[model samples]
Target: MTRSMCRTRRAGKSAGVVAAALMALAACSSSSDSSSHRATGSAPELSGTVTVFAAASLKESFTALGREFQRQHPGTKVTFSFNGSDSLAAGINAGAPADVFAAASPKTMAVVTDKKSTAGTPATFVRNQLEIATVPGNPHKLSALKDLTASGLKVVLCDRTVPCGAAAEKALAAGKVRLTPVSYEQDVKGALAKVELKEADAALVYKTDVRSAHGKVEGVEFPESARAVNDYPIALLKNAPNAAAAKAFIALVRSAEGQKVLTGAGFLKP
Candidate 1:
């Protein structure tokens, strides 16, 4: 009776061992199935949001490009914070969660570089020249920076801290002209907006802005602008959450596809 009982116990242990082996085999099979599914490009998709802080003048073109990028990368969303180049640089330096940054001038970009906020060297993606923007029909006949100094002319200029304003000062100095503006606007858009609203007779702004404004303002080209050309620099932020997407977006802006759009909207390829 004791021998028979021992044999039964041994058989039960054998069955338990077999069950453990089978369970392990099943887990291995499921793992392999999952790996095969991923190998066949059935893995979960890549998707996320990226934040870009850009110069104020880039508002229109960058917004359009952001839309195009979304169309290309369906799962990615782009949010832009557009403001003065100096202000944007300050935000990034202060640890803003920016995936990318685009500035109107290298001077402003230097702030990011100095703070080590840029992932790599910022590239010159585009260039812009200054233009005198006035109300439709050439009411002021303000075709040049010198025209701003004429009596009864209400000229608006970007603040000295802003890139556009610095460029304007350089052009004015180069042209040997001095004029007092009605207001020193905080940004180029603000200066241009003043002209659009008829708050000022003339304003110095990017030529691209005048084009974007359409019937809102007429653009006047001056030769002095040649000396004050502003370069647009773009870079992926060092702490970017979506570094891959940021790089792809920057590549697109430097690509021929981007150049076409930028030029059409009045930006010169650098």
Candidate 2:
């Protein structure tokens, strides 16, 4: 072969090799992008029912959040079981079918995590403070933590094992007030219900719970509540029936829109 022809042929072969290398790199880049998208859940459009066992205090806000999540995810369904955080945690430990667990207190959430029932570290999405929930119009003019101790004023409180009860106790202790309740209820809602149904003159419950009652109950914020704040934590279950949906639901709860709803319902941002 002529020298010039040989040089051209060699150069052509080198060009082909470089082109092949570039193509291989492009293919690798595309594969990596796809993998990253999957890992981070690009689009995150999820389906299936995500069963969430949440604290009673979260009933109203979480129900609203669930509807918004379904609206955003189209086919995803969020079903919730709301009760005392301690009770829900116990149910989880007993092999309950739950995709996610949102507790009103870290202690309750620890019940699930300590049992190795969580797929990820729990996140504190909100904090709540206790308030005196009294009957509409405050006939007794109940205004402070100490007011519950008034003579003949029937009061109800959450059981000490629950978050609201724990916070109420702390607040009362901080204010140096001693109260004898007519009943110790299982959850914040139940405590608030005591006032709404007139079963008791007042109940120390979460500010959020009283707000959800929409005037059926009136809320009285006490200074001692600042010391008794409770953090609400959430996590996906280790054996979540719909892991992807559970993750998406949690993301929504931590989102700004979710915070707006929660704050509107009187939950403080974490």
| lDDT per residue as tens, model 1, 1-270 | 233332211122322432333333233334455466668986443358878999998887777778767755568888999999999998888888989999989999999987653556899999999999999999777766788899999999999999999999988998999998899988889999998999888899999889778679888998999999999999889899988788878876786556655665678889
In angstroms, the error of model 1 at 231 is: 0.8
Give the per-residue Cα lDDT of candidate 2 at 32. Answer: 51
- Give the range where candidate 2 is weakest over 10 consecutive residues by summed lDDT: 6-15
Model 2 scores a C-alpha lDDT of 0.80
Error of 2 at 196 (Å): 0.4
- Which residue segments of model 1 deviate by more than 4 Å? 1-46
Per-residue C-alpha lDDT of model 2 across residues 38-109, encoded as one tens digit per residue: 688865547899999999988877887787667555678899999999999888888889999999999888
Clashing pairs in 2: none
What clash pairs does model 1 have? none
lDDT of 2 at 196: 91
Q: 191, model 1: CA deviation in Å?
A: 0.5
